[model samples]
Target: MIAATRELPAAGYAPEVDGRLKAEFTTRLRQAGGEELKRRFPMLRIRIYDAQTHAREEI
Candidate 1:
């Protein structure tokens, strides 16, 4: 698994906040042909985790 950590402001820990990051990341990935890359490498996945709440979501 690939893991990343970022220190966010209190309000930045909300789902909408994280979701926006996910959306933007996904958009950039897709623009860079992430779909084709994923097809070639099926194990690739993007996930988000909240450190404060210890919550996780796959995007």
Candidate 2:
């Protein structure tokens, strides 16, 4: 996902893209929850914050 994030030249991105990526990441994280990687991806909730505007979103 770093590659996709790097494609943008800013601190933020499109809400739709962010939403899609968040869903995909969350799914993959849950699917790969093996004993070896336990506690590695503790994503109980997903949130995105805009530091410039002080806005936050829970997805």
- Scored by TM-score, the top model is 1
Please identify model 1 stretches exceeding 4 Å from their true place: 1-43
Q: How many steric overlaps are in each model, in order? A: 0, 0
TM agreement with the true structure for every prediction: 0.28, 0.27
- List ranges where model 2 is wrong by over 4 Å: 1-43
* Residues 1-59, model 2: lDDT tens digits: 35544222134422222333332222223223332233454453444444345454554
Model 2: per-residue Cα lDDT at residue 48 = 44
Clash pairs (backbone) in predicted model 2: none
Candidate 1, residues 1-51, lDDT tens digits: the string is 966644443332222232333322312234244446456767757344454
What global local distance difference test value does model 1 have?
Answer: 0.41
